[model samples]
Target: MNIKPEGRFQVFANIVMILITLIAIIPLILLTIASLTDNSALIRNGYSFVPEKWSVYAYQYIFSSGNSVPHAYWISLVLTASGTLIGLTITTLLAYALSKKFLPGRGILTFIVFFTMLFSGGLVPTYINYTGVFGLKNTFLALMIPGLLMNAFNVMMMKSYFVTSIPEEIMEAANIDGANEFSVFFRVALPLSKPIIATIGLFIGIGYWNDWMNGYIYLTKRTDLYSIQNLLYRMIQNIQFLVNNSSSLTGADKSLGSIPSVSVRMAMAVVGVLPIVIVYPFIQNNFIKGITLGGVKG
Candidate 1:
């Protein structure tokens, strides 16, 4: 077959995309190298894409000193997993019902959801509600519930997917076969909508993993309930606090020798972000497919 001009253009586009991908990934590669390099060398010589000397001291520090690191890791894992599972389920079911034409009062419900995106009750009122009315302060629910659960945008995405991609005829057939709404949604629609499910799952999972605000606001005084992000936030605050108080904490004449501030901050960032970096690629293809398919039909 003779190659068309369009085919030649596509080949050129692929090469350009490859270059762009490399450009995007180069910084992450540099960060990993810096994380492995000795902090003292990094400070003296400055960071390079290539490390002068390699050490695992950062990782060692994180894992050392009893089981604090392991405990934090477990808490983060549990919160991410549980929050993602529950949030995805609720978002999907609610989105599915709202996508249906016959569902009563969907317009009002959707308006309410969209309204939340535009406005909220502000921080003080929200804090008061969660603490006073809900009594969710300093609990694991505080970490899992606020901010991370059932986002309005994610629900709209799912609703769009169901509206555009799912066939009305197929739903009618399922109803004729004596399947109830719940059965049809779970056994039929949900399975066929794997791409959207995976997409929403990734969104919810990432939100849960990266969230520190809820833990900060509602989880005061509960170090045990901190997420990995929250722990990293506290670590940064502690570093700043030490820097501010160094003159008093140490003798006025003494210096703390820089405290590995930049390197330690970078190291903490790497630690907090490592899991998402590892896991995102596994679902990335599905996420793209979901968004592409969902957007066109909806």
Candidate 2:
């Protein structure tokens, strides 16, 4: 029997997808296994699919710390949700306005928004301004407002989607029916913008969830406000410090020896990414569609 060209291509494509899926999934499997492996075994054998020894000390260390991990998770959740909501609102509003050709000063406004995509104020100036003028330092706003709040790239992406995907005639019809700009956006533009909105929202949510820089720089005294990333980082640093200095410290030897270092790092990786991995499947269809359709088409 001879295979049809389409059948051959389909078989090849399926195999390629299977390989790609394994490539993506294997690392996560290894990470979880390594996290569960005994610390001493990890040091002696390195990472292996079949660990000789198993341990839960890494998780116990992370979780038994008076609800710190869960609290950090909560902070990350709040930050992601709030940042995504506010960011989507601002980005969509700006992009919608910029998409309208008849709007006054449209060219100038578009140029300014585009300019930000290419360049940004230096870090020192940004820090000083946010700290001195905006006064967002050492607060929760420090995490949400500074950098992750919005992106020029996202604005441009949404603008392109609006211009290319949505028809101006439909908007005109809504306006002719006594609908104002806000009503048109609420009733028409937004409903048709699910793909881009979801894509941009996921971007913002991930950024906020993974951010440790804002916390590290701003929350010097507010350790309680540390997100999961920040808290995991601190745990690793503290463990490393104790292990490195265990010889000199009188009482640190027993305490440090009991906790798993190498395994804890792996365990932290699993914990940090677990939420995103769990949620990706739910929005993955929208995410894929947005990626394909969000940019300029035709």
Candidate closest to the true structure, highest TM-score: 2
Q: State each model's CA lDDT, in order.
A: 0.82, 0.89
**Candidate 1, clashing residue pairs?**
none
Model 2 scores a TM of 0.95
- lDDT for model 1, please: 0.82
Best by lDDT: 2
Candidate 2 lDDT tens digits, 1-298: 9999999999999999999999999999999999999999999999999999998888997898554998999999998898889988999999999988889999999889888878888789988988999998889999889755469888988888888888889999999999999999999999999988889888888888888988998888888899999999998888899988988999997887788889999999999999999998989998887777787742
| Model 1 Cα lDDT, one tens digit per residue, 101-207 | 89889899989888878887888998888899989999998887785446888888889999888888999999999999989998889988999889988888888
Off by over 4 Å in 2: none
TM-scores for the candidates: 0.92, 0.95
Q: List the residue pairs that clash in candidate 2.
A: none
User: Candidate 1: which stretches are off by over 4 Å?
Assistant: 1-3, 65-67, 251-259
